[model samples]
Target: MVARGRVLVIEEVPSQETFALWDGVRAEGWDVTAAPLAATVDAVRRAAPDVVVLNLHGAGDADRRALYLQAAGRLALTRTPRRPPILLVGDAGPDEKPLGVADVIRGPYSARHVAQRIGSLSRLSTMQQEMMRRVETAGQYGVVPPELEPSNQFHEPKVLVVGAGIRYFAIERTLARRATLVGAFTVDTALDYLERQAFDCVVLNMRVQEAAEFTARLRRNVDHFALPVVVLADPREVDEVDAAYAAGADDVVFHSGESAIFAERVATVLKEHRLRESLKAAYARSRDRATNDALTGLFARGFLLDHLSRMVEAAAHGGRLSIVGFRIANIDEVNRQHGYAAGDHLIRQVGTVIGRLVRGEDLAARPGGGRFVIVLPDTHVDDAAGVAARLGAVLRATRFALPGASEPVSAEVVSAVADRIDGDDAESLVARVTL
Candidate 1:
């Protein structure tokens, strides 16, 4: 089994009580290192402890508290990219708060209290390291893309934790106890993960360095904006809580030391997210059924005509628009020779070819049986004629294999072109090309 985690104990001068606390922490299965307060900077570099326990009971005056805080700041500066959580064992006067510290316990406490705090912090650290290891390993090999399916209800919720701090990883551990965690080391990595995977909720710790910036960044990204974010706020820092809301946090989870609360908050957000996704998927399916043809997978005739009206209106306002119309002359012959299924195969093949030739913004539709139309935006009459000519040539040159036939059938295509005129409506423009 792996060691639980490492702890660094810092003291101005080692006392009997401090040694006793560390002894208890060690018995709990942690790698404990005791160093004088003056040598903390060096000892942190060597041991790389996950939790730093600061012993300040020896300080008898306010000046000593100031010095201890200064020393804590120096230790923070020594670690780059990621700083360990600091657990202070000292008494704080009113209006006294140490920056970047995780927790504080007053003097004259038992060794068990210190051990409890260290255990919690160490467990969180181990969770972070383990989750990050899984992420980096996946990045090396790669993950298969999720299947495209209509989601009607909640699946297993994949939660993303967006920092390496104590509460952030603790939330990861909490959620992992109930669900699997999709971990990320920074906001950028989280954004990348969101693009590559489907997640139900996100938990962000505002205490991490540059966390506020990352939250804003996540909000600005279009792909990640709708993702539900649960901000873990420090109950004492009112400004941070407000900032999290201003940055578009969907929910806030205050640090209350209860893991169950964290897990429940994530579950609630996940339910909401699943509902939103279900509505979106249902809307898309309904829209596609209304607008698309059942056989050819192209836009339906009525929808295409309505869209052509909009294109014509835009062309009247100084934009260019062209239409290419084509009809397969041998479609009836093929149907009679083989069957109706062969005719459908021909139409689908023609639709696929047109789809391949058109630009992403161009629209392809079948206004009637064997008659196809392509609306090309920002195009002149010359270009439209060129597209029509290309369609005719391709249809004649390519032989399509019909179902249960020994030989392939060559299609004969008759094509026409139309450009938007000064006095033209959707019906007139479409008639000029089709008739």
Candidate 2:
């Protein structure tokens, strides 16, 4: 299996608690490393972690501050193009908030929650690095990338509160200062609100089962798949917390009635969500007609080659690049049974499914006919194969309607995965998978 990302834990004294935390994070599919505070600088340079976790559990105020600064400074000095974010795994005073820290997990926290935060930070770091590389490649083709101008206008985040009683009031009061709050007493009402207006985050102030069900429902919708969902649950119900994460809750906060802490956690999740939205917009704006397939709105064949070439060159420096190639095996059959127009319609629907399934950073291209390729940067061949499987499953599940067909037709998608070899170029890399 492909690891989520690499994480380095910097702790002065190792304890059973810390060891358990490492085991849990590792179980979550992350590569975790433990190092002492004295070796912080060298450990980071040597490990080149995607995120750094600082254990400040038993440290005093001064000690905590010093450790945080030292870790952040050493990470800044590291010569890697992608600098890791610091995740403080203990109490952080109000005054201890620093500029490079991704988040601070205070009070009694679960290992699963910490792992989720690490995964978020790691993905953000990777997206930033990918953006930089894509910009350079676009420039090479004389295609000017979109300028991400700093906006002077500030909009308050809109938050939806789904629950009832005192918790709803507490959430309203907590977010009133920082956001605009809308309350929904029932699941149907919450779904209605979601369809009508946009929200930065959804706070489920209900029972664990209800919250999990609502979360799963939101995830099924394409528009709301990436929207952040925070579940407020009773600390005593440990199994419910696991179920929440399993149902796709972004963060599960045990209800402690601490309004300030809840507000801060919600803010942290919102910040990451907005940052991802900005990056996605930049990716969309960076594309032009010359680079995109007109019918499918995917990357064109020529642009795919150019981008793949740059990715292959970068792989020499140390990184993984894999391609998932797909072909609609029955396109010609569909054309013969129906007409050329029906074939085109089927192709368009397939493209739409592929576009929805891929990550923002993954480049999906329609290289013409029934062939499609998805370039997965920093992805291993095994992971690439998993992606291909998902695409195939979804395509096979979908039934395309034709102009003169008695019944809806299902797609037969054939897929192959190829990782870049030592002597592979853009043409050879794509051919290995597609051909």
Candidate 3:
């Protein structure tokens, strides 16, 4: 894969021996360098590497989280002359808490897996900005790019002009040249359908309906959403232009000019909106990257807490809840004996087997570390324990192939399970595993 810059390694023990072993990566034409763990940001600044590999030293969960954020923040805020993606290597120690973030590789990670992750992150950076925009919009607005114009066509300007007045008819004719008339509204009726569908712009003519009611609904919409609007009013009520704008009208037109000008104003607003969408999309992407781990496609730490908290509340009123936290021991040894890629394969295998073992209503999530927690609703303590034992047995039974290793590697699991007792909440339930 192609990268924009070199990769810098920051770890507790970036010994000459470690560097020698990783020379295969250097052989692949990657400029790999090592620096002291505390000098992560400094190394990043000097090397300006595409990826940052961390050699953790058995830090606790809190420390691991803080470190992950520290590195992630450095990557995000320190705008360089040239920015490269940050890839973290978390294979430094056994029982070390990892953020489950930034290309995390626990102990025993495969060298090939590490190389592939670095390569893939670089390739992902080459994703086209236009394609990014399209993707960003798809999640929020169900729209196709070419269909934007055709979709905006609401009604026939000619047919709409048949009733209003001679001056209005002239205005409609002018508008007909530049814009496709969407649904037209006279005095009594305003748009009731906009609430249901996505619209880039809305056109409301107050000539037929009372301006106050129509404006009221428009104002309600303004309170509810952000959509560009053009209000058509009687020339006599031009004094209401201030109110129209206040009520969220982008442009207000009367018999003062033709419909052509009205259409032009609407088009301008839509163009501005496209820019707003881009900014919003980029902001959202950065925010998502902040807490989310891209590899497993799991919810971020904050999201998981908010979600599980809500689940706990629901479980309080609805029924009992059980939760289990599990960790795989000896996997780190496997990675060191074999390679990180094999370790990653085992993690995925564990995740899959545990996912399949749970009930449909239950939730299984990794909260920022290698630690996996499963929440089972309406489950008793005994059942929760049984599930945990079954999961442990699965880990014990499953055999995995390793890279550059003599024998197959499997997991040794230590798990804790608990159920709601009395009015116990999420934090307390989770603490039960500790008890």
Candidate 4:
């Protein structure tokens, strides 16, 4: 189990309330601090909180958010290349105004909610810092060697709670069986020590209201963080998980419904980048086989439709578009005289000629046994026709010499107008040009 780290609470509440919340966090094995919300910036810089919780009930909630954004933007520790998780505690408006903390809590925070939020935000911050450290230590190559990996690799994903009273001890054993557990404190020395450590993810199990407020405070800090965050929400409103992400929660899982998914979900996110690389390689190979012809270097007819459709979605405004179709005129005669190999050689040459004459965006593909289509994006019909005419000239000029050939082979190029398409869809545009 990983250790719980320091947590700083900046609340506009009574000292006793702060103490109570402070006690709950401490019971969870955390070094907790209850400072005035106004002094949050200095305290955080001085003490450097793993997680900072703010109360909108404090003076100038709005200003705090703005100042925090600016202050956090410059803080070298918080602004490290990797980002931390933030908690905001507040109500949802058209915009969840920044309370200057990473996470926010809605008004009427509960002790349980505050405790959970603290736990989650702290771990997430730790994870964010870990990723940054990893990326930095690897330098330009960006690979974490085995030595580096084992030296200070983060613990397996799990929630770590600070303070002890909140049943943090029991959960520690439970989490350790399947996940890594962590602990820390808000006291200056303890906070300093934990700052050097790392974790995989964070979960804040605060009361619904405190979770909201804590989430609001956490928003800025985690805005740039990539670590996964799960808010401990009541099963009743589990559907509000979507709202959580919209406000900056990486993830939200109800303890009642999601006990099974916690460990698995954490592992998936931590490994997401590697999985993406694997999937991308597989997809590229499959796509190449489907789109490219083996014998001739031209794309297949089916490939044209698929690629054109995709390109249309990303086409530039007022870009030119053109399409050309050409017939082999007398492919059978040449096949009969020479052989299949010679025929293939001629096709390859024609594909090469078309490829050389066109731009990178242009598509040259064999539509059928003896037909070809050239799709030219960002081109006018007249311009495409002119290019086709030039290509026809190239075909006539090039003597496609066969192994035993005495003369050169030529092709008849036919082109039609498809200038200035009204619709953006690929099929309709191709139809207009083909017709």
Q: Which stretch of 10 consecutive residues in model 2 shows the poorest summed lDDT?
A: 144-153
Q: Residue by residue across 1-435, what tens digits does model 2's lDDT show? A: 456567898876667887887898898778899887778778887887778988886345785658666766666666765578888877677435565676777765777878888877776676677778778777777888886642112888889999887878878888899999999998889999999998989999988888888887776665676679999888876566777876668888877867777888898778767766676567677778877888888889998998889888876555678899999999999999998888888888898878766766788899899889999887767667766765676678678897888899988899999988889999998898784
Clashing pairs for model 1 are none
What C-alpha lDDT, on a 0 to 100 scale, does residue 165 get in candidate 3?
42
Q: Model 4, 1-435: lDDT tens per residue?
A: 112445666565545555675686676556667676557557766665566655444435666545544443443354432233445544333234343345444433445445555655554443333334323323333333232122113434444433323534544544577666665322233234335654455555554454454444433331212334556556675445445544445555455432334443344344442232232232223334445666565766666676666545534332345677766666667788888777777777776666545433356677666566777653446546655665655565566776446777765445555543456576776666452
lDDT leader: 2
Per-residue accuracy of model 3 over 298-349 as CA lDDT, tens digit each: 3344544554565576455533567888777776776776677777766776
* True-structure RMSD, every candidate: 24.4, 3.5, 26.5, 24.5
Q: Which residue ranges in model 3 land beyond 4 Å of their true spot? A: 1-300, 422-428, 431-435
Instruction: Give Cα-based local distance difference scores for all models.
Output: 0.65, 0.79, 0.52, 0.51
**Model 3 / residue 244 / CA error / Å:** 73
Best by TM-score: 2
Superposed on all Cα atoms, model 2 deviates from the true structure by an RMSD in Å of: 3.5
Q: Per-residue lDDT for 105 in model 2? A: 78
Clash total of candidate 4: 91
